[model samples]
Target: MRTVGHLLSRPVAIGTALVLVMLIAGFVGWRLTGGGEYVAPTPSAAPTVRADTVAGRDSLEELVAGVRDGAKPEGKGAAAVATRNADAIGIEGLSARYVAESGNVDEDGSWTADVDMSWRAPGDPTLSEELKVGFDGDGEITGFSADEGTRMPLWLSGPVEVRRTGSTLVVVQASAEQADRYAELAASAVKQVRTVIGWDRPRLVLEVPASGLDSALGAQPSTYSSVAAVTATVDGSSTAGSPLHVWVNQDVIGDLDSPGAQVVITHEAVHAATAAPTNPHRPMWLVEGYADYVALRDTTLPLSKTAGQILAQVREDGPPKHLPGKAEFNTRSEHFGAEYEAAWLACVVLAEAGGQEALVDLYEQTGRGVPLERALRASFGFGVDELTARWRTHLSDSAR
Candidate 1:
C-alpha cells in the first residue's frame, strides 16, 4: 500500500521542513531453516546449534494476568519483586489500560511477544502499535520495544503522561506536568488549523517524547534525523483513513520559546487538518507552503528572520528561477531550511495575487482530483509558470 510521510525537521528554533516522507519499497525477505528431527551433516565432527526448547505456538494470556484499568505493570523477571516497589521495567508509568487485541507469541517463547496493542486517552481516538512485549512467567510484562531499527512510540516505549484537551490529546514521555503544557500548545494548534480550513477531525493527537530523536515513531532514525515534528498516520502507513497524529521532536522544539513552539505545532496541525494534500500527485510547495502560510500568518516575525535562509540565497544568487521541487526538500540539503522558507514565500505570493480564498480554492480543487494547471488557472487566472514568475518577483521584494 502507498503511504505518505510528512517531515518538519528543524535546527534549534526555525522551520526547515521536508514534509514529504516517501517510504522506499525494496526490502528483501529472508528465512532461516535449521533445528529439525534430523541432525546437520556439515557439523557432524563439530558442535551443532540446536533449540533447547522446541518451538511451539503460545498465547500470552496465560502469562500476563489481572491487568486492571488505569494501572501500571508492577513486577517482572526477577528483580521487580525483589526491590523497593520499583517498576519491573527500567522505565516507569506504563499504562495498563491498553486492550490487547491479540496475545500472540513467537515460536521460541523468549522474552518478546508480538501483540497488537492499542491505547487511547480519554475522549481521544485510539493509536495502535505492533510492539514486542517482554514477559515473564509471573504474570508481568518487563518492557515494550519495536523491531530492530524501527522507532518506538511513546505509549509503548515507557511511562507516558496523557493529557486530553477538547478533541485533542498530548501523550508525552516527559513529566506529567509537561503534558499539560503540550496540551495547551495542542489547543492553540487546533485553533490555528480551524482558522485555516475548519477542523473536522474527530481527534488530534500530539506526541512529545522526551528523547525526541530516539523516539520519532517512524522507520529509520536517519529519516527523521532533523525533523522537529511530523504530522502523519499513527502507524506510518499512507493507507486512506489511517489515524493522524502530530509528533514533535522535543530535542528540536525545546530550543524554541513558547510562541515559537506554538508556531511549530500549528504548522504540523495544518497537516493534520488537511490530511496533507491526501493525493500524492499534488505539488509539495502547495501542500507545505499552505501549512507554513497558516503557521506564519499571525506571527510578528519579519521577512528577514522568517525567510532569512531563502533571503540570503536570493541576495547571493538572486531569487530562485523556479519553485522548490520535491527534491529540494531534502532534510540533508545544504539549504534545507531555506527551501521551506522559499516555498512559504511562494504560497505568500499566491495569497497576494489572488485572495486567501482563491489560494485555498486552488489547493482544495487540486486535492479533489483536479489538475494543478486547471485549478490554478480557474482560481488565479495563471499557470505554474506564471505563479513561479510572480513568486520570484515576490522573493526579491521580500528579500529587500
Candidate 2:
C-alpha cells in the first residue's frame, strides 16, 4: 500500500465529538504515558574494513569524512552508526543517509561533528527523516535529533506546501490546490482555538495527509472510521517536547466548509492547544470534556443540535447517574456520542458555575498530576459529587 509518510511515536486516546447532530468519532486529547511498547529494529550486518584509509587516524573521523563525501559506511561500523543514530533521533526501522556537515577532533582524542542526515523506512518511501547529528570524540553519534516543534516525514517535505498561520505551521500533504484549501480551514480553526482559550501564542502543527491516516495515527480504530480528525503526541512522553500532530481523516472531512468538519477541526485543535502528558489518575472525562467544551463554546448552533445524542438518551433513560467515565468514552461503547455529550455538558456546567478561567485552571491543575477532585475544589469551590449533581441538573435543563 502506498501510505503517506508521517511520524507517529505515541499511543492515541480515542473519543468522539458531535457537531450539528453529526457524530464524528476519533477526537483524542492529551498524551498518556505507558502505551504500546516500542519495537526495536533488528541489528544490521557488521561493518566492512576500508583498505583506503591511512594509518594512525580516528576511524570515526574517516567515517565522518566519508559521509561528507556522500559515502555510507558498511558492515559493523554501519550497524553501530545506524543504532546510535536511531537512538539519538528517537525512531527505529530506518535506513539513514548521513552527511557530515562540519566537525573537528579535540586534543583529548575526541571528535565532534555537525552532521545532517535523513532516515527512511522501507515500508514508507515517501516519508524520510532529516535532523542534525552530533558525534563524540570517539566517533560515536551524539545528539542526533529533529526539532520538537514540527517533525514531518519525507512525503511532507518540500512541494508539500507549508503555510504559517499565527503560531501554527500547517503542512498540507496534497496537491497545491487541495493543500491551499486545507490550509485555510486549519488556519481558521487555529485562530478560533486561540481566541476562545485566551492562548495568545500557542504553537501547533497540523497535517492533512493525502492518504495514510492509519499510518499517521499509528493504529486506526474500527470505530473511528468516520472520525474527521485526531490529535496525538509525538513520543508519548509528557516532556518529550515533540510536536502534537493533528491528523485530518480526509475521507470524512473532504468538505472543509461543512459544520461537522469545522467543528472537528476546532475540537482537535483544542486538543493540540491544551495538550500535555496527562496524569493517568485524573479523570479522562474532564480532559476530553474540556476539549469538546472549547470546541463548541460560543457557537450559535442549537443545544438540541449539538447535544442531541445525550438529550435523546435522557428522554429515554433520564439524565445519567454520573458524568461520563473513562470507559464511557471507549470507542466501542454504544454510548460513545452520549458519553461525549455528557462530558461536554459537564464542562459547560463548570464554565457556567465558575467561568472559563476556572475551567482552564482546573484543567491545567489536573494535568499537572493534581487530583481531579482537589483541582475542582480549588478552582470551583466544589467537590466532584457536588459538581456531578450540578452537571446532571444542567443536562436536564439543557435537554428540556
Candidate 3:
C-alpha cells in the first residue's frame, strides 16, 4: 500500500496523533448481564424507584424541586447533587450507588459511566463495587448513579469487535479471558442506545480486517469521510440495513493517545448501533446533531470556541437561512468548530426542555424512522423554522 503522506497536515496530524495517544487507554467498559431476571412478588408487580423518607428533608426537597423546576445547582457532582436533591425531595434510601470502578475522566474533568451496574445496591454487597452518576447542565441527575459497594462479577473480555453480519449486526473480539468483557461492552453500548430509542442489537462479527476498506465495511462506505484510524459516513434515507459503520485502526490497537478518541469511537458506535426500521433520512443538523450529542454530551470539548463562532456568524449574517446550505457550512464549518458543538447543544436544549427521553424521541424522528421536519416538531414541540429561531436565541445566551 502506498503512503498518503501528502494528505497529512501538521495540525491534522497532531489531532490524529492525539487519537493515537488515546488508544493506550485500552477498552474500559462494564455491563449488567444475566441475573436470571428480577422475580416479581406477583406477575403484574413492578418495583418502583423509591424515595420515601427525608431527615435532612426540608433542604434536600427544596434542592430537587429547584432542579426539576430548572434551577442550576451550585456544584458539578451529579451524585452529590442527586443525594442532596433526593434528600430535599424526601425520598428514602436515595443513596447514590458507588461501585468501585475507576472511570476515564474526559478533558473537561468529567467521568463517563463505564461500570458494571449489577454491582449496585440491594443485591450481593459482598461482591459489590463503587459507582458514579451523571448530571445535566442545571445539575439534575439525568442518568444512573453508582454506590460504593455494588458487587458484580466479570462478564466478557476480548478485542471487542462490532460489525454487520448479513442483516444482523455483531460485536465480538477479545481474548479468551476477555470474551465476557467484550460481549458486555458491545451489549451495554447497544442497550444504552436502545434505552431511549428503540432498536435491536445486531449480530456480532469478530475478525480483524486485513484487506481493503470494503472488507472492513462488510458493506459499502457512505458519503462521509473514511480515513486512517477513522471511517465515518452519512447514509441517506434508506433502511436496507444499518446506516453507520465503525472500526478501530488495527495498527493503533490497545492505545489511548487522545482522550477524545474514546469519545469519538463511542459516538460512532452509537450511530452504528441505532438502526431503526424506517428510511434513513435525517437532516445534516439532526444527523450530526445526534452524533455530536453522543460525541460531546456529558463529556467536554472546547464548546466556548464554538459558541463564540456561532455568535460571530449570527451577528454577521443572522441565524442561518433555515438549515443553511451544506456547501456554505462545509466551507467554513471548522471556522465555527461548534457546528458539532452547536448541534449537540441544540439537542440537549430540546431534550431538557422536553425530557431526557426526548433525545431518543428526536433521534427516532430525525433518524431513519420519521421525517426530519416532522421529527423536529414532534420532539421539540416546534417546527424547523421555530427551532432555528430558538437555536439562534440559545447561541446568543451561550455567548454571554
lDDT of 2 by residue, 5-45 (tens): 11122223111212412332212211244345457889998
Residue-level lDDT tens digits of model 3 in 1-400: 1223432444557666666556644322112333453466756764443221222233334544543454535654433444433333223322223233234433433333333322111111212223334433232333443332231111111122333323333333444343343334444445445554455544322222322233333334331123222323222223355334344443343344443444445454556655422334666556556655665555555655335666666667665555433443352244534465567667767766777677677776565557767776776677777777777777666655
- In order of lDDT, best first, we have 1, 2, 3
- List TM-scores for all candidates, in order: 0.72, 0.59, 0.41
Name the regions of candidate 3 deviating beyond 4 angstroms. Answer: 1-195, 202-239, 242-244, 249-259, 276-278, 300-302, 305-321, 324-337, 366-370
How far is 55's C-alpha from truth in model 3 (Å)? Answer: 84
Q: Looking at model 3, which ten-residue stretch has the lowest summed lDDT?
A: 151-160
Residue pairs of candidate 2 with colliding backbone atoms: 46-75, 46-76, 47-74, 47-75, 47-76, 110-137, 111-137, 126-155, 127-154, 128-154
- Candidate 2 local Cα displacement, residue 103, angstroms: 40
Best by lDDT: 1
Question: Local error of candidate 2 at 140, Å?
Answer: 32
* Number of the top-ranking candidate, with TM-score as the measure: 1
**Candidate 1 vs 3: which has more lDDT:** 1
